[model samples]
Target: MAPSFYETLVERNKQYAETHNPAPTIAEQMALGRVFETTLVITCVDFRLNPDQFLQTKPEDQFLISRNPAGRVGPALQEIMLFDVFLGLKRVIVIHHTDCGGSQFKDADIREAHKSRLPDHSEIDHMVFGAFDEVEQSVRDDLHLLKTSPYVPKRISDQSLGFVYDIKTGLLTPVE
Candidate 1:
């Protein structure tokens, strides 16, 4: 029989620990010297939208990535608050991408699709899927969210930036 997904993950992790840094390196190590030096990346769950590739960071870059369905700041607020208090966050980068799945669907669709899987259909109503119609605008919106959020400190908010990553051309365009 084929290995279960969990088993496969464990096996792959074992290999990673042996071959990789097995701990934070590069950017993470550098941030240790200064408080609020760590850069927090809020990116999409899409594998093709890997922030490391577009940001010129390596696996060992050890940057913190808070990935959700659409990389929207609303959903990542909790993590951001916690990270700031603990890891001392410096920069908040919001990255949305071209041809993103988040743009393909609406929150209503997500609610309907997930309704069947839940014990109570109305339970799905409370969830936000973070869908957006336009990619660039989404990034800008998230950046604005971070900038205005009272929870996000001025140190982190002032440094917040947004970008739209192009999957086809492998480029990232800043969204002002």
Candidate 2:
């Protein structure tokens, strides 16, 4: 039998641990001072968009990333707040992309699909999947979300930026 995905991940991790030099542990970050010199990347879960490649991030780069289906900041606010409180975030980069699956459907479409697929699960009727109409507008909206959020500090919020990663061109264009 083939190894499960989880088993493959574990085997890969074992190989990774052998050669990779990781960034500072959370304890190291805490001992260093109040703010960590880390930039946080909020990008899509799209398979083609790798922040490491696009951002030119080396292992030593102090960048942390949090990814969701569409890279929507609304659902990731708690994560931002928690990371800021604990590890400290020097910057927040929101990167939505062209050809994004998140922009492909509306809430109604998913809700209807769910109802059709799982008719008995009435609780799935009102679920919000963070679907957005436009990709650039979504990035702008996420930047606004980070800026206006009370839980995210002014220092961090001020440094927040947005971008639209072009999958076809393999480029990142800043989103206003």
Candidate 3:
């Protein structure tokens, strides 16, 4: 019989816990200590990729936000950043992984795929290149957006950081 998804998850969690040392109780959280430094990690929406696994940071230590293609931080992401900045978050990490779906299809193809479902008057603009086109360039653009956006605290100009991850080797290299 096949294992249930929940069971598999529990097993994985148990394995992780055993490997990382179990702190099953909330009292252990106090022992773990609080993470006050604010760091934002942006990555793709791919279910296979987890920013936390790469970060290897404790839970609640940093904000991990994933976007499609990892390009152009969307409105929701901006809101999170705004909240973090308000709360005094100073570091930002933008991660774009290899072989992104957003980089797989051209804008016209994407638009065409949704044209029938979307309203005729919808002002949807698609990207020209897919994930493979220019991931490095995309990371650069997103970094600039976070750095220059009026919503972000100006003090973060020199402090925020960006990184790119290679899914193949599971390696993370700095973008800036």
Candidate 4:
């Protein structure tokens, strides 16, 4: 008789919990959640990368978070901006990291791959990858899109800032 997948996972989790030790002073430190009116962070969907870790932000600092491939603000993200901005959110932080998986494919390549995988849908030849392999350009482009998007509030663009994250050095450098 073999143990089920869930059983194995549970056993591993229990073992890890038992072996893990917390930092002696970390628990005693007072953690006051950050306060902000409007702060949205848009970044890539890579599991290994976390936007907050790079930005050195507290958990409650950002009001909204939207993640996609290359962290490019597409149609869906435009809609998110409408809600966040109209509701009085103050800032939009565009983050694009180095060494992203989306950087592996070009616009044409991605379109062809999607067309092949999604045969039932219309061939996606018109879907252009606005920001290709350029991380800095991508972040800047996203900020531009958010600022210029018709769905977004006109004032939202005033406070938006773009940043590029270096995976190797863990640095968040401003784009513009």
Candidate 5:
């Protein structure tokens, strides 16, 4: 048989480590305690929507990225608060994408699916799967939540933005 998954991953990682060469400016900025210059991005865990390409910027060392099912910030409240209060990050970019898997099901659909799969576990009721019916509305709702959250600093909250990424067109539309 071929190499196991972990073995393949290790081999690939070794290749990556040997070839990877980050910019010297990024290193210099890090040494001077200046890394990212702008907002934190909260986006879907979808494989299609790569933030660097969508934002048209290299985000490796220049952004604080948070990925969730629907790109909802509600589940990442603690991290967001810490970044805002201690790290001095003053803005947030919430990006929800078109045709996301998270938008394919409703809460009730998820609940029933879970019940069918595991008949004994009734606690799945307490889970909010963060499914979205409309992508833009989901972006708006998440933005509103972040702006109103007491945990988030006022400066960051005021500057928070929302967008919907179109996977087919590679276009980002502001959700307002």
Candidate 6:
């Protein structure tokens, strides 16, 4: 009787498109194949921690965002490699947040759950869920992983940084 879930999304997107205007300058740059200096931001898939809000910049600007299970750069290394090689990626910022759902469970727990729930699906056993315990340590580890990865350029790796976002306060603290 009513619109489906995807139909609702289409309607919402139509409404958003009506009010949100595309930046002509950014559009022109993209059209011209111009490579702009941009920072690659790796953050958790958590909806509470927004890269745009924390960085105070629009997506159209010089920011390439990658959201993953725990904000671990290792999982998204292919994308990072491509961006670094072609997208003028000069910096990398890894942001792991406090009170993350990924930190709530261990890898073993997730593996056991998957095994129990999907006994016939043995392929899931090899999957790395990226569940973590220490948020700050995870951030640092990710930063190190990015810095040491051969796929990431030395210039970008040298500038790589780590941060912990406080979901409750909407504040980011640098993780050294």
What TM-score goes with each of the models?
0.81, 0.81, 0.69, 0.70, 0.83, 0.85
Query: What local lDDT does model 5 show for residue 171?
Result: 90
Candidate 2 accuracy as TM-score? 0.81
Writing each residue's lDDT as its tens digit, candidate 1 over 82-165 gives 988887677888888888899999998878878868757676788888999989889888888888888888888898888888
lDDT of 2: 0.86
**Deviation from truth (RMSD, Å), model 5:** 3.0
Top of the candidates by lDDT: 2
Candidate 2 on 76-130: residue-level lDDT in tens? 8888887887665788999999999998888888899889989999899879898
**Candidate 4: clashing residue pairs, number:** 1
Cα-based lDDT at residue 8, candidate 3? 98
Question: On residues 1-176, what C-alpha lDDT tens digit does candidate 4 reach at each position?
Answer: 89999999999999999977663342333243333365777788888787766667754464567787777777446546565645447877788888887678788877888988997767487786644767777777778787778766666668888888888898889998
Residue 169, model 4, lDDT: 90
Candidate achieving the largest TM-score = 6
lDDT of 3 by residue, 1-176 (tens): 98899999999988888768543465565467753466666668787687767778785574645465544454335654665655457666677876666666776776666776775736655433333467777778777877667777666546656666788888977886
Better of 5 and 6 by lDDT: 6
> Which sections of candidate 1 miss by over 4 Å?
1-18, 24-36, 58-62, 116-121
* Model 4, CA-based lDDT: 0.72
Ten contiguous residues minimizing lDDT sum, candidate 2: 28-37
After superposing candidate 3 on the true structure, give the runs of residues whose Cα lies further than 4 Å from its correct spot: 1-35, 74-77, 125-132
Clashing pairs counted in every model: 0, 0, 2, 1, 0, 0
**Model 6: which ten-residue window has the lowest total lDDT?**
21-30
- Which scores higher on TM-score, 3 or 4? 4
